[model samples]
Target: MSSALSTVIIIAALLAAAYSLVTALRDRAMGWDHLAALGVLEALLVAQMAVGFVKLAGDGKGPDDTATFVGYLIGVVIIPVVSAGWGLLERTRWGPGVIVVACLAVAVMVVRLGQLWEGAVV
Candidate 1:
């Protein structure tokens, strides 16, 4: 996994989380802006996933728990989409709140993924 990409994703997710929190606090429902943020985040995650898969496939230099690593990669990619759908359906301030949680979760998951790639038992 590329640390630079991971850092970018983490930063972006946290920014999105902060923005979503503000929106929720203002009692606004999920809006196109929130969805756009999620869309950008999703694109970054997909890029990261692709990089991870390529690295894992090359020269067998991956973590021992390959399945777990793959799971994280896939999970991170799915999270934003699910949350966006849930947020849209809710039609309340909690919609952005849900996005905040998803963004924060993605940040943490990206960190965990890096540790896993390094073979750390976290």
Candidate 2:
């Protein structure tokens, strides 16, 4: 995986997470902007998936454990999507709270992804 791409995903996820956190603190419901940010984040994740897959297929550098790395890649994509669906159904402060939690999860996964890419553990 590209360090630059990984950095971009990390920063974007954290920014979106912060936004969701603030909205949740304010007791606001999820809105269009919140969904939009998540959309962008999801796009970045998809891009990362493409890049990761290409790298792996082309015999590019990857984790010592490929399965775990790919599992994380799949997870980051699912987190926001699942949370957003549940958030919409919630229609309360908890909606934004769902986003916040999902974003935070994504952030953690991104960090782990970086660690896997760099051959670091824990």
Question: Top lDDT: which candidate number?
Answer: 1
Tens-digit lDDT track of model 1 for 38-107:
9999999999999999999895788889999999999999999999999999898999999999999999
Identify the runs in model 2 with alpha carbons over 4 angstroms from their true place: none
- The global C-alpha lDDT for each of the candidates, from Candidate 1 onward, is 0.96, 0.87
> Per-candidate RMSD vs. true structure?
0.6, 1.2
For candidate 1, the TM-score is 0.98
Model 2 worst lDDT run, 10 consecutive residues:
53-62
| Candidate 1 residue spans exceeding 4 A from truth | none
Residue 87 lDDT (model 2): 83
Score residue 23 of candidate 1 by CA lDDT: 95
